[model samples]
Target: MEGLSELALDHVAQYFSALSEPSRLRILNYLREGERNVGELAEACECSQANVSRHLSTLAKHGMVVREGRGTAVYYRIADESIYALCDLVCGNVAKRLEAQASLLGSLAPKKKR
Candidate 1:
């Protein structure tokens, strides 16, 4: 049981590590729209082709995304829609927290000087 738990924890660590990169998050966000080829994804994410490919490779290895080749271009899409749902949940939680903080700050702000 301990071994199994350790394995599960390791898998979770890997998933979180893959998500720790801003570029990777951007790529995931772009993929949320639809499947896109490497070049198009690079353009959308504002990264180089090689950089995007590297990030995609990492995501592919972790089974978070999948690549499909057509003619000369290779396209990528989320491996499972469940990943998108998780991302949405996390982003929504963060947004709510930020909004609450903003409201608190607004309430604390003093009136403008005369």
Candidate 2:
């Protein structure tokens, strides 16, 4: 039973490891806006089409995003809105922490000369 639980945790860890990349995180953030074709996503992320496609594939495999084919174009969007909400929550937390750190630093800094 313990071995089975450990194996499940390892799989979950791998999923998070894939998301730890900056490029991938950017791709996910862009998708939160709306469904977009590969070219648009590439432009928004400032990455090559091929690179965006590869990251999208990884995200799709992990069920974080979904790909749809419209005629000849393939578009991607967040697989689950809940995931977007979770990402928003995380972003909010980071912003709050940064704001608090800045306030602390400001308090510790010497006053500027008049």
Candidate 3:
């Protein structure tokens, strides 16, 4: 936020908003492997081609993924690998919180009769 102007902040908000959808996250995960054409992504995601295209549009808009046009076909790949690291960091914190909650529940359980 230090160097970000108001418009930059708005763009940043849109970027996060794009990543907020599960479908979009799954698309990014698929791209972690390598570039894939829209048809391939659509098949892997078990959704319609239009749906995949829409998700890809959002991902491309946020610069999370990059695409190339080869003749009439287009392929997409992850533009920012750091997004995976961010996801991992958040996942780890969630795991720790869940473990702590489980431990607390175990302590609060009624004791067995002698």
Candidate 4:
């Protein structure tokens, strides 16, 4: 928290909030393979082109994805690579917790019924 202003913390929170949406997360995950045009993204994401455009707009606004216009189609790709690492760290912790819970359940003995 040292050397960080309140405004800085709020900005960071906003960045996380941008990633909080499932559709936005899906867009990020799809872009991990490389850039894709809006039409391709819409088909891959199984949503309408307008919906995909909205998600891309939010990502572009937050500096999460880069947009390129080639002729009539617009392409999008990852802008901040660290977002994947952040997601991976959270997933790893959840996996560890689930593994521990499974082990605990496996160790429980079944009670005999009379």
In terms of lDDT, which candidate is strongest? 1
Per-model CA lDDT versus the true structure: 0.92, 0.87, 0.91, 0.88
Superposed on all Cα atoms, the candidates' RMSDs to the truth, in angstroms, are: 2.2, 2.6, 2.5, 2.9
- Candidates in order, TM-scores: namely 0.90, 0.85, 0.79, 0.81
Which ten contiguous residues of candidate 1 have the minimum total lDDT?
1-10
* Native-to-model Cα distance after best TM-score fit, residue 43 in candidate 4, in Å: 1.5
Candidates sorted by TM-score, best first: 1, 2, 4, 3
Clashing pairs in 1: none
- Write candidate 4's Cα lDDT for 26-113 as tens digits: 8888888999988888998899999999989988988999998888878898988987898788779989999999989878967669
List residue ranges in candidate 4 displaced over 4 A. 99-114
- Which scores better on TM-score, 2 or 3? 2
Q: Tens digits of per-residue lDDT for model 2 on 23-42?
A: 98898888777899999989
The clash number for model 2 is 0
Worst 10 residues of 3 by lDDT: 83-92
Task: Order the numbered candidates by lDDT, best leading.
Answer: 1, 3, 4, 2
Error of 4 at 7 (Å): 0.8
- Which scores higher on TM-score, 1 or 4? 1
Q: After aligning candidate 1 to the native by TM-score, how far in Å is the CA of 67 from where it should be?
A: 1.1
Model 1 segments more than 4 A misplaced? 1-4
